[model samples]
Target: MGFKKHLSSLKSYEAGKPIELVIRDYGIRQKDIIKLASNENPLGTSKKVIKAIKKEAKNSYRYPDDSMFELKKSLAKKYKVDSKNIIIGQGSDQIIELLVQATCGSEDKILTSSLTFAMYEIYASHNQAKVLKTKDGVHNADQFIEIYQKSKPNLVFLCIPNNPLGDCLDRSEVYRILDSISSDTIVALDCAYGEFAAYKDKNKEIKPKEIIKKYKNCIYLGTFSKLYGLGGLRIGYGIADSNFIEMLSKLRAPFNITNLSLKAAIIALEDSTFLKNSLKNNFKEMKVYEDFAKSKNIDFIESYTNFITFMLPKSIDSSSLCEYLLKQGVIIRDLKSYGINAIRITIGLREQNKTTIKLIDKYLKR
Candidate 1:
């Protein structure tokens, strides 16, 4: 038997290893390992969400609501959007795949910045769409406008506070891309880390909701994986024009989300206290990272998200440095996969952050 040529050319996504797997591989105790690879919320899921999950656990025999009506309603209320404009997915990654499946064809091109989220490229390839990589590690709106004018891509993926780099484009830049693109082209804004982005000057406000409302061709993708600490649950959603939402609904599998996950998400959404605390802690830890990098005279990009990406000194090999950190029970992301000589480390608990810095200092000194 033979597969399609496109399928053969597709590269599988390499996710971060589980703590248990890392422990087994290194023959180290689980207690000693600290994983900061995936940019997860170090505070973990809210207590209310935990309780909701536990309460719903006994009802595992029942299938989830295919419409996800309750969850959709909660989101609609939170974002001030209509329920008809929302569609749920297993995660933001799944939403990206569905967008590609619905809109893109084998010869269609998807435009994205270089070194953006890897999943966008993977999903585009899976759907047989040609991907056009931008020149810079950062996604500049002007570059996107130029590319769109020349190539006229069917779809575009923009990661605000982009992965691997942790930098976000200003609202004016995003608006320029949105305004310049042809109406026939679709724009997908991946705001998975939106909640972590602080008020930077006057232009960096969270604007995806407003953008979705303004542009019929625009879709806003969000995930509970980062802010709500629900990565294990694999729950995320998209907000778009009602017509696009309807199309996505038809393409989505029934019961795509689990009952427990729905319940947890509902509770998580209502946990204002937890959300506040998580954001506060994230800012505090991020400042610590910033101060540490400054003190060490290290070059790092200022992050608007939970993760920080810093260049490795010319004397040190990034992969080897990562390995050294791993041996010391500190796990962080190596950006070699993204064609960069940098590493991304997630902001964790205060004690964990201190320990990670200490370990990295020890390794760098030697």
Candidate 2:
């Protein structure tokens, strides 16, 4: 049997190790593990979300509302956009896939930074398309525009407050690309880390709805997995012009979101006090990471979101550090596959944050 050639070369996404998996591998007790790897809410799921999940679990046998009307309505009200402007997916990942499928085909090129999300490349290449990766970890407007004009990619994927690295693009850079790009070139803006961003650095953050409105061709992708602590629930959404939403929704799998997830996300959104406290905790903890890294003389990005990326020294191997941390029952993301010699650590709970700092300090000394 013949398979698509792209299937042979595509690299799969490596997620942060789960607590159970790490415990089994390291012979550590469940209570002893510190998981500051996935940028999940250190607070865990909200109590209101848990209550809603329990109530909605009984309806799991039934499919979610095919239209996802209520969820979209709630999101629309919060974001102050019409429901028609939004699209729901299993996660921002699924939306990425659909965007690639909807716009790209054989030989069509996609543009993104070299060290950004892997899924953009995975999905684009799976469709037998090309990816134009920029040279730097940070997005440079002039360089990207030069490439965009030359590559004239069918799609562009930009991760705001980029993953693993936690760096963001300048608004001028964003506008430069958006304004210069062809109307037909669809730009998919992954705002997965946007919620934490606005609180820390409002100037660098992109306002999804406003940007989408300004650049009618841009699509804004968001996820409840990180800030909402619903990774297990897999709820995410996209916002664009009505026509763009309609086009992408056509490619979305029917009833893509689950009943329990829908309810949990809705309740989670309403729990403003939980959201406020979580943001406050994250703000405080990011400083802990910064101060700790500074004391160690470690090169680390002052992250805009819930994580920090420490550049692995030339003398140190990233994989080795990761293995040592894992065995010590602490987990953080390694960035080897993206060709970066670095490790990304999520700003976990206060205790978890302290534990991770201790582990890294020991690793450095050893």
Candidate 3:
């Protein structure tokens, strides 16, 4: 009646509180609550995606395309990569799990920053691979290269515009790490927030396809969750070398992605107007939050993504501050989970952003 020791040792991912949970805990009405905790799109899914989902709703009785042919083909055309190089998943989360299963073993190790995305450590531990925590929070390329030269891991998970901190390693730093790592090591780049990152940067844009083509071991992971606003559909994909794609494809469960999700993702990609609007709204809100933080004399990390992380005064505990915010019907993330004395607030709709800032100002004054 016992599970593996590693299973017992694994820490579960702590997701944000649901709106219902916040309402129940604070005895507040659901209508008053605004959740900015999970880094999800506040605008929700695009109209085209919603239409596609509804149109395909009647086909629920039929099995989905296991190969995700059309989705893969669309992605291939969009990224100018070969269809053979693409592998779709329930989400980029599942793709991360699949990559661990496909490439790692009990004796293998997975390298990643200490406070990066929690999934990297979770999946690595689930696969019984040694989770090698890196020293830097930013995943500096020189630090990674120094460690890889010594430990030589089987897989590496790098999150650009790193979660919680919202700090991105420069492209030059990334290139350095790529050049230093062993050719045998598989590098997985989690670009879940890549679209938002690109939208935030005024001077630089990262073309993931270029890196994918240049390095055989490199794999780029993208999700419809952020910019396209398809978190509910749970659709994502990986772009890599054909051999890696084929290997990962074999391990992918049949009909792992729903027909509705695939249809929605196809339309989401084509909705250029929605994409542009989402970026515009996010950028505008980001500046508003930055100015508000400055006026309040609060220190915050500059972000190249939709979410902003800021520190509470030393006199206030983040957990208590989050609790207070919850009672006020604003649910922002408590960075205690990420081992920081900070909180992350996602860029929401203008009204929501304004309300959240007012609430924070009120809380700080009291």
Candidate 4:
């Protein structure tokens, strides 16, 4: 049997370690495990979203509203955009796939930060498109502009407050890059962690409507997985010019989103008390990680997201540290694959954070 030639070049994405896997391998009790690996909401699902999902569970037998009208309309009113400007996906990840399918071909190129999300390259590779990264490990507008001028990639991904490593490109820096790129290049501005950034600093908010109105080529990607605690539901969206939204929608399979997911996301958007409490607790807990790093004199990025990345000292091996933590029933991300000797941990609940800190201290001291 033969596969597509390009499939040989891609490696499967390694997600966070699952608790059940740890239980089997390390023989740890399920109740003892904590996962700070995937940047999931530590608060768990919101009460409002849970109730809505339960109410909609009986309707799961029927197909979802393929149009996704209500959810898009809800998102539109919140962002002050028209319904046509929005497109829903299984997750913002699916929208990434749709954008790649619509814009990329074997002859095309996709550009992104050197240390950003892995899926941009993975999806681009599925189409055999060339992937280009900035020379700088972190997102630098100057480097992006230089690379864009040289490669003229068909798609550009800007992961705002980027995943794995949580620093962000400022609003001004983002505009500068958008200004430099040609309208022919479709830029996917992924704001998966935008809520955390906005909570920390009002100036850091990436306004989807503002960007869409200013740049016809720009598409803003957002997810319920982060702040909304809807990772399990997997509902996300893309906001762009109605014209671009139409083009992407044509590539989408009918009913890609489930009925329960639609209900959960619609209510998730309106659960203001949950949203506010989650954000407040997020930053409040984030400080614990920051201070922990400072106390150890470890170098860490000034994160604008819910997670923090700690650049370990030469004596601390990221993989070894992660393995040690795994045995103790704690799960966190290792960035060696990202070509960095660091670890990324989600800002968990107070007790989870305390247990993680205690375990790390034990490891470092050992």
Worst 10 residues of 2 by lDDT: 200-209
Instruction: Please report the candidate that would top TM-score against the real structure.
Output: 4
**lDDT by residue for model 1 over 1-366, one digit each (tens)?**
587766876788877757987788898899889999998999998988998898899999999988889999999999998889899999898899888898887889999998898888888888778899788887788888889899999999989878879888887888888999877899998989877764433465555568777898999889999989999999999999999888778888888999998998898999999988988888888888888888888889878888898887788678888899888788999888777788899999999999999988887889
- Deviating ranges (above 4 Å) for candidate 1: 198-202
Provide the global lDDT of candidate 2 against the true structure. 0.86
Per-residue alpha-carbon lDDT of candidate 2 for residues 144-176, written as tens digits (9 for 90 to 100): 888998879999988887887988876667777
Candidate 4 lDDT score relative to the true structure: 0.92
In candidate 4, which residue ranges exceed 4 Å CA deviation?
none
Model 4 / residue 211 / CA error / Å: 0.9
In candidate 3, position 77 carries an lDDT of 94
The C-alpha RMSD in Å for every predicted model, in order, reads 1.3, 1.2, 1.5, 0.9
Model 3 regions lying over 4 Å from their true place: 202-204
Residue 120, model 2: Cα distance from true site in angstroms: 0.4
lDDT of 3 by residue, 176-249 (tens): 78888877889998888888777766342556578777888989999998888988889999999888788888
Residue 255 in candidate 1, Cα distance off native in Å: 0.7
What clash count does candidate 1 reach?
Answer: 0
Clashes by residue pair, model 2? none
- Model 4, range 117-145, lDDT digits (tens) per residue? 99998998899899999987678999999
